[model samples]
Target: MGEKQGMKGYKLAIGLAIGAALLLPSAAGAAAAKPSYELEWEGGGQSSGTVIARGGVSYIAAKAIASEAGLAISWDVSKQRAQFDGWNKSFAVRVNSDRGVLDGKNTEIGGKPFVLNGELYLPVRFIVKALDGDNVKWNARTQTVTASGLGGYHARSETHNGLTFTVVTATGELYVTGESGESRKLADLGDTIYGAVKFAFYDSPGGLLHLTVTRNYGEPMIQYRVYTAVLKNGELIREAEAGYFRRFVDNATNGGGQLIVTDGRTLELVDDVTGRVAESYDLVKLGGEEDDYFVEGVGPEYLLIRPNDRGLLMLIDRKTGGKTLLYKELLDKLNQEYAETNDVPYFGDWLRFVRRDGDTLYFRNDAPIQQDNKLYAYKLPE
Candidate 1:
């Protein structure tokens, strides 16, 4: 394979001098030269391990090989056998044995296996070539190795129709692949990604994908930013200038969801077109012993609220100023069970469960012994 130019790593010109190196005597001598290759993972992350020259062959660290190639490898110390699996192929070998088998074919590695510092080492060039039978290239001159055509570290995956969306956690890059074997990078989100990045798909006028990226600093007082991006014109574009949200909008729609910014007292429902507050809901004083309350979401008729220490979920009618307690039994049951606060959703909202509109809501018990996963129908107040 040709080397990608302007790539800080990999020199495609020197192709490992494989033929010439294989001609050397198989017995490695104390005087023979052993060198380390700089390992660079696709899109980032770099590490290097020494490649031992033994019996005229090159042996590499097993863990290093598995990581760089994204292979799942396990060594059976008792049997002296190591099994390697990746890229739809499997290979097996025994330490100190060159007569290995890959995909039922007899194979010989670059050198006799060696062990260094309690880690098993195997033939370097042979294992790399085994990944799809020759998609990787090594350079003896630069001592750099490159593996091409392998999928990225598949951190998360979602399938719609025949297209699969995968996220590479090492880098926040997104990729979409279809059944036709055609694949493309959906978003080049860079290398400095932190925490879980969520994607919401919408098949509106045209197909659109929304990405919500969050980075948690793990402190209660310091503010954090939540960025929303949309796939527009085949590009991932940020919706608005990323602003820190006091109250984040839980986009609970199948295709399109509205954004609401709040200052604890006044909730501003923003118009996506005007980028201004189209309407506002000020927190009204419903006379009671209010310890702490949160504005959950505003519907066409009522606003959802859960105030106090008991996890009492209530809905306040915006027009009538009447409050209806929707879910009190389950929340109280769960809170009393755990001796902690538990929250549940009321009826007439899509976000009652799993960010998908559903009539059923689930309340999970956190006790280690019980391990209860309670499901309840979103019940309307009588």
Candidate 2:
């Protein structure tokens, strides 16, 4: 009996030791799960947008955003829906779906979708807006779609069945294959006769294409322009011209045969054929300096703008200019993490910057204080 008891005690000790060993890794893992200090922010604000949390990070839609404090994020600014990240995840998904439908990769989402560049692509507008008195609609007869939202935002476009559809955004341009078996600009009407004139989707008139003549701005100004055209029987035709605009950011569709243009501080609705500004809005006073903006047209009556700062997101009314704070205190923790990673001070009057592969924002430091070049990856609130 004594021997058996001694043996049982020894087994108990061994079991306890084993249990402790198993728990050690779990404790260490819990400690590691704590957010890293690199994700903190110093300041942030939202005009009238909502903050959305996904995968432990927070993001704000561009339209209704005012400013953010954690990290400075930049987009390609030339491509319609392209963000700072080079992956173009949205486009990739769309293209992949397209190819899957065409090539039979995997029939999952709706059906066997199509693919492009090994990435899926979808037809949804890369930039959408949510605001009061905003309307979006699609017209099948004219093959046109339109949007009208806050700040008089509007857009419209006609598409060809078997052609390539292309749209430019801040980050990069994207092309979608049309049913016409040829690649065409998604927003372009067709090829124009006059090589000098270029066209773009202006407003909801559903009229001819517009034209814009490019001017030389010398060395200081990098000319950024958008043109739309129409093509028939492989022949290009010139329809209209929208004059060169500054701070061109993104594009959106309005239901009434109009197109909306965002120039960072304002939104412009243009008439498709006449290349005229139907309406405009000054939104600079609505938000903070670091706010991010995005615009999208939903149906025929609403445009949505989502802004986020410090993990707070809000949706604003574009027409009424009313604001709403969606999420709060969600990003404060992440802001702290970002503060810990950046120790260097921001100097120099102007920082020449560029984005690489669409994900990383890089700046050439001309300041006398710093000699080493610096690169910053776009960071979101954790």
Candidate 3:
């Protein structure tokens, strides 16, 4: 797939700062002012986010806040609502509305959620406190929102085929070795490797490793690159022949944008496929990564591993490298509903987060929603 699209063999572009402004109506009856925020993670990793202020309050990007706390977010366009979930709590707030339902309780955030330049901005401290109580530390001096007391990653396991890959990071190199003890170095990543590189089997061929990454630690668009590890005698011998990568901006910007692969140029990965319809609108940012999964273009924090198959859903905390389980809740709920309605015996069938269209997240499940009937769909969050 990467080779045909010219993503394979593409070189990384020079790290560039991309900024463009599209003014939005202000809550204070004036134009919203954009603010650049510096995010300091627990592990000394940092990234910048664009913030918008309303009525003297700093409305941090909801995605930025969610990423810090290892949460999932979505947008519902039809109802003009923004949704967020973490641990076991969920919240849904409608745009231009003062009240929202948080964990089944009516909580008042006072201000409404709004969009600016294709990003969703909301009351940051309020949302952070709502989902992750007492876990956030707001520093007025450094202007950084620090998140502490988070959970740890689940135990790492072997692949279905029984291959275990390990990555050892250094100042400028990554040492990758298999359980068989054949190790190799990946230095093309750069002189300094800032993110954790992740790898999995290619699925098509044996002994082929698929490497995913997010590099440069720069920008709103996180480029996910894919590399094929050529193996001889069960040991990786060289880099990908030509690394293919994909560029993903915050879903808020192009909620309905085509899922495409690009190098120096952009190309569509899906053609003639429609995005799931959303009820309300919520701006969502692609969850950023730090010390979490890297490679195949440094990847994001939130991902549906094996979505169509086992549908094991999880979110990773970049700092602690922890993985939180979420798929079981949805799967158990939906599967029970299906069995009750159809009068069938319990089957180990499952649901999955299959794809995304703009601000909408699509799932492959038997939810009694969406007339399409193939996938269970939900709006931004609520």
Q: Each candidate's lDDT (Cα)?
A: 0.52, 0.34, 0.42
Worst 10 residues of 2 by lDDT: 35-44
Candidates, ranked, TM-score: 1, 3, 2
Ranking by lDDT: 1, 3, 2
Which candidate number has the best TM-score?
A: 1
Better of 2 and 3 by lDDT: 3
For model 2, residues 317-341, the per-residue Cα lDDT tens digits are: 5555555432221223333343334
Query: What TM-score does candidate 3 reach?
Result: 0.28
Query: Could you list the CA RMSD of all candidates, in the order they appear?
Result: 17.8, 26.3, 29.7
Prediction 1 global C-alpha lDDT: 0.52
Instruction: Looking at model 1, report the run of 10 residues with the lowest lDDT sum.
Output: 345-354
| Better candidate number, 1 or 2, judged by TM-score | 1
Off by over 4 Å in 3: 1-47, 77-79, 131-382
RMSD of 1: 17.8
Total backbone collisions, model 1: 6
